[model samples]
Target: MPVMNPMQEPCSIMAQPPFRSFLVPGQPVSHPDHPEWGEGVVQSAVGHRVTVMFPHAGKVVVNATVVHLTELS
Candidate 1:
């Protein structure tokens, strides 16, 4: 008799499957010559610029290219 393996179901929208990258609000950012946009929440993602809310600077738009993604600890 041959044993059949169980099929795995696809991941749902709510479930963040492995091997995929996603962005969320309230993430830190950095850039040279500018004050650390430390721990700013992502307000909106528009084109190449993303509007982020800093702790003391309030809301400000930053170039998406300038924002470096941090590795998950």
Candidate 2:
């Protein structure tokens, strides 16, 4: 039997910002297309957008400036 090396593939370069400890209070986050899928805490923020992870829906990335969010104590 002969041994073979693993195949490699090229991927797109996505510029992501560093994680910061900041949360806005009473922020409304909604999806660009579907507003009903928008709900939950701000899991992470990147630039003008934040990843909203809901308890029932899951996760949806939305604009931080538009979504009204609040920090949970």
Candidate 3:
């Protein structure tokens, strides 16, 4: 079988920030669509994608455009 290699970007580029996103690392948030995931802490936020560490759901990536994460105080 012929070996295949994944395509790589010519250059690295920064992603555009999500509109009206106030999420940050270590900030607590909850998923409105999936309450079962319970309260989660923000692991990383880049562009519209947010990495949340949930107690029940473990680590999950969510799109801020589709589901607005509820920020906890």
Candidate with the greatest lDDT versus the true structure: 3
Please tell me which predicted candidate would have the highest TM-score against the true structure. Answer: 3
**Residue-level lDDT tens digits of model 1 in 1-73:** 6555577554475495433224455555533344565556666665556776767678877665655544222
Question: On residues 1-73, what C-alpha lDDT tens digit does candidate 2 reach at each position?
Answer: 5555567433333454544435543344444445465456666666666777765578766655665454444
- Candidate 3 structure quality by residue, lDDT tens digits, 1-73: 6554667543335464436556999999999988999999999988788899999999999888898899998
Poorest stretch of ten by lDDT in candidate 2: 8-17
Better of 1 and 3 by lDDT: 3
After superposition of all CA atoms, the RMSD between model 3 and the true structure is 8.1
- Candidate 2 TM-score over all chains jointly: 0.41
User: Lowest lDDT 10-mer window, candidate 1?
Assistant: 16-25
lDDT of 1 at 3: 57
Candidate 1, 22: how far from true, in Å?
A: 6.5
Checking candidate 2 for backbone clashes, the offending pairs are 24-69, 25-70, 27-68, 27-69, 28-67, 28-68
lDDT of 1 at 32: 37
Indicate whether candidate 1 or candidate 2 has the larger TM-score: 1
TM-score of each: 0.44, 0.41, 0.70
Per-candidate Cα RMSD to the true structure, in Å, reads 10.1, 9.2, 8.1
The per-residue C-alpha lDDT of model 1 at residue 63 equals 63
